[model samples]
Target: MRRGFLWDGFDAGIAAALAGDPDTARDHFERVLGEDPLAPGMVDAQEKTRELHALAADREAVAARVVHSCRSKPGLDPVRLAMS
Candidate 1:
């Protein structure tokens, strides 16, 4: 397979894993690993895949909390948000 194909497959795997499809994600990730065993991005992709899997496994604990702090109610600091 082409390098771009592997890259796209890896991207899709991350998306699938985040969307709660571990089987498909694992298959795609394995394919990516087979395609480029020594690629620099393999480690990062593997780590992110595992993270997404863990997040999917415990989605309830990863709920988003709306922090209503002392900031302005109507607007956010664009610079601060960008930095974050």
Candidate 2:
């Protein structure tokens, strides 16, 4: 039997988020929310996806800052950050 379930979108969002594809995850989560914005749990999932994307962006920003810091500082290598 074929099914058109809302949770499918939610689950796909989680999987994409875990795979480091927050934009895809948000797209999925938003699709579910779009179906029923007032549905129980759907709102939460939407918020969670938004937060996850924000966090991912923040992490990338921090990493960029670290890389830039390493480049600007004298003889400080970001690769050494891994050794420490």
Candidate 3:
């Protein structure tokens, strides 16, 4: 059930991102993060949404990256990725 919420938040975030609503996506993803910070793909979603929000194109591509990261993260995170 918890995982359901996780993915719900994740999917909502991705949908919002793809719809060109980074702020909404961030809000959804924030719920996911609050539920489980260590959940798979969350860090990437957070980071991607942050950067994606600043741009104006390729929202689908950005959302794809976030989904991919959520699918598989090789130890990357918002803070570390942000720093680099």
Candidate 4:
């Protein structure tokens, strides 16, 4: 099912994040959010999928904020931001 595909992406994202590969995790999470055929005929499944996508988006926003903060701070190691 389409919903299963979305869930697989979400799971992969979580695994990538836990493994410290933010780029890959972001890719998977974005795929989950982009796939729109998750629950073709079920409103409840669609709503749940939307909620999960929102959670992923919130996590993404937080990560972006952290990266931005790290990038703007003076004297911090550039390696922390993978800049060098």
**Candidate 2 residue lDDT tens string, 5-79:** 666876676566556677776677567656645566666655654554454434354344435554766875554
lDDT of 4: 0.54
Query: How would you encode candidate 4's per-residue C-alpha lDDT over 7-55 as one tens digit per residue?
Result: 6776676566545676776777667766665456444434543454444
Residue-level lDDT of model 1, residues 1-84, one tens digit each, is 356476677666666655667677667766666564466677765564454444443323212111112233467542222111
In model 1, where do residues sit more than 4 Å from their true spots? 1-4, 37-84
Residue pairs in clash, model 4:
none
Whole-model alpha-carbon lDDT for candidate 1: 0.51
lDDT of each: 0.51, 0.56, 0.59, 0.54
Best by lDDT: 3
Report the Cα RMSD per candidate: 9.6, 11.7, 8.4, 11.1
Q: Is candidate 1 or candidate 3 better by TM-score?
A: 3
Q: Name the weakest run of 10 consecutive residues (lDDT summed) in model 2.
A: 75-84
Off by over 4 Å in 2: 1-4, 37-84
Q: Write the per-residue lDDT of candidate 3 for residues 1-84, one digit (tens) a residue.
A: 255456677677767777878778777766665664475576655565455444324575665566556556666453312211
Best candidate (score: TM-score):
3
The local lDDT score (0 to 100) that residue 57 gets in candidate 2 is 32
Worst 10 residues of 3 by lDDT: 75-84
